[model samples]
Target: MIFTTKWYETVEPAGCKQRQSIVKALGLALGLLFSGHALSQNLVTNPGFENGASGWNTSGTTSAQIIESSGRSGNRLTHWSADSSYTVSTYQTITGLTPGTYRLSAYTIGGNTDDATLFASNCGNQNSQTAIPAAAWGNWTQVVLDNIQVTGSSCTIGIYTQNSDWTSIDDVNFELQSPPPGSGNDTAVEILAGKGFNYARIRLLVTPPDSYALHQDLDYVIAMAKEAKANNMNILLDIFYSNWWADPGQNWAPAEWFNQDVNTLENTVYNYTRDVLNQMAAEGVLPNMVQIGNEVNPGMLWNLGNISDNGWGNFVRFTNSGYDAVKSVSNNIPVIIHYAGVGSSATSWYASYTNNGGKMDAIGLSFYEMWHGTINDATTTISSLHSYFNVPVYMVETAAYWTSSDAGSTTSYPQTKQGQYDYLFDLTNAVKNINGFAGLFYWGATWTQSNNWLNAPDWQDDDAATRSLFDSNAQVNPAASAIVDAGGLSIRGVDISEAHYIESNGVEYLDN
Candidate 1:
């Protein structure tokens, strides 16, 4: 069968039962081209650019085509597919139809093994989209969304497939008997961040068995990326080279690569990094910034981990390999070198990596104070490194807990509320003092936990309450609120004169 990545068609269902009603409606209002037409009640003539909700959807977050404003060029439909596992795309959702009219309609091209189902239902109700064969997979036909009623904000949109092949969706959008205002534009990120949160981080996974920090949880990795992207949040994707998960303490090799030679292993590592990077680029899911290695207190790829003279060569090759692999996909994606902070291990690792010509876009560190050392010591070391390394530094992983009993005790530092508050305030302040420092990343917010998920009947609290910026149920904690709202107390040596402003609006012109 032939595969197509793109196709644009004027796909409107052709039928007798619907034409008369549409004609009646059209007669009442002056007819105009969809894109240009703007009725007093309806904003845009064609709100659903796809023209049909075929092979795609606009309901729920996951397993649906994403709807985002294409910058300023109106709205857009983005699909982040890593490979053949996913296909089909549309940016259309239908609602507010009359009692007699169905909620969804679509025109599709044939090539499908079975009839393409157009699934839909009224909003606020159970969503179901069942398709009527318009055309085959290679041919064009009109598909009507049935079992739907026009109701408030509720709309059903999705796809039903019988053949298990990559699906293709094109020009699929809404078919409202009468469309609404230009369409309210709001991003999930703006919505969430408005509620609080300034930065978002997504974890990217390598192959299985040797997974990086994700521990081979590729599904969660994808889910997290989708969630952050949908929220329109800035992302810092953390990458680990191992197939499973790897950090300073554990960097287990995948069972497959166990027997491979060091040279072959290095190449394997580079390829894995590059392949995932390329996949992310294609999906447009690549983070604003990418961290090549996580908590490399010892080193990454093992081949370069702990030899004095051999440190530079192995470190250089390993880092450069990952670096080159990423640059090969998109050079603009900044690469960060992450280390453990407070403790001397991370600092020593950085000394080795950078000395061996391992280029770093950003110098990142993780410090828990309890695990590493005193907040003052960690922040001071970070500040000194900024001046010495001539590179900007940031607290990549640092948290000021809020009444979390599970958190390790910092007896000398005190575990009271005020102490927790003081720790965060001081630590953040120190980050502010570093010259090249960007900002602090407080590991972050917890949405829903194991105890209180929608399906878990026994899940009582629902608020997992680990290291959440927000409380158990997503309520803003004092620490997070204090930082975003008050800007917290001052850092000893921190100079945020540059951060005070937007800093070039995050854009710069090239001389060349």
Candidate 2:
């Protein structure tokens, strides 16, 4: 399979038709180059400068010409040289854009001068700017001006150089940054954060170097963490204990851990957890909450930690090892034990693990309406867990569909745009009504790109076509408003109340 993970592809019958549509859509889109990227249109004309600034206007001794093979990407790049006696610049005016946010980006390989700047501006005060910091020549540097709001119907994007030697730019991109029409006007993170959401969840894996979005790697995770922090949101780092997806059906170990004994495996888990956290901390993007293993209801590390085979002893040992490792790096960060199940399955697993001395600060649950039943079911189960175990519960992963197909309307919900909104509104309200339920994280919120996985040997799962908050065009769904409107207060700190629970005559009890 070209794609490494398909956890979102429901094995249930309802998902079969949806997956088929996704596969068909992907095949058609790939044949044209890309199928799902929202940036299908590069609004800038002659953006690569292969046409030698034909679409751009110049000023003041500024000469713009294309040099073949000089671009960091593509075949040609635009080279700019200034006489240094006055300001020299080049610009292109873009029209017919609706009022919303947009981004302008370009790559430059030379220009050690500090007087260079990139800008997006036009009538009615829509001006965004980015200063290219001083750096070495010959090494390509990316310059971007993001979050530039357009109040008018059009804008002009360009680069200005004053008293600078030379700078070659390529792959200039300027496009609508807002989600496609009907999706919403704001980013999912921005919308949710405005609604008082205090944290964002990011999952990481160790293998498949080129997973879509490079989500499994540390660099991507850290970058996401930085963005979350900038949004005033905390982070939940979910470490999937596998080179690929680690779920109930399969929990394959990383290549380095293969052939290792129980003791060695334990050490590996401990050290890996500690080092990952340490790196995150070093980058100043440490998570407030970390899940040692994702959906570890079946246990982790395969047979050794498999609850069905080795029982709770081995599972608890592995859990505690990870817990201790997390503490060794950052003592204050809360560790969570995530699992998939509700009702007796949830209660039974917790009972066994806690009895065997498994240590976790919180409990994370993956609750999907298709698999976990109704809203009432989730609230009731969460309430029961909190009442019994006295720990905070988070719906770490959940998503509902807007339309059943890429363009068709048919779904478990209303299948209309509003139906999508209502589902999330109801889900958020239900989670908030539960005392111990903190918040919910919609899975695959920004997976709107296509890749080789969409080709033959298809896994038949493309989230951008279904559960993602964005549509195939990368527009935010109306359902995103539910999160935008939900004023979630941060409750991520230590729950002192949980520590005060009591037990009498073998009956565990807690009074809030």
Highest lDDT scorer:
2
Residue-wise C-alpha lDDT for candidate 1, range 290-322, written one tens digit per residue: 787777666665543433424556656666777
Against the correct fold, how does model 2 do in TM-score? 0.58
Predicted structure with the largest TM-score when compared to the true one: 2
lDDT assessment of candidate 1:
0.47
- Per-candidate TM-score against the hidden true structure: 0.54, 0.58
Query: How close is each model in CA RMSD to the real structure?
Result: 14.7, 17.0
* Stretch of 10 with least lDDT, candidate 2: 496-505
Per-residue lDDT tens digits for candidate 2, residues 280-373, read: 8877788888898888988887878887887777767777888999999878988899888677688878888898898988888887766777
Residue 335 in candidate 1, Cα distance off native in Å: 1.5
Collision pairs in model 2: 180-475, 183-476
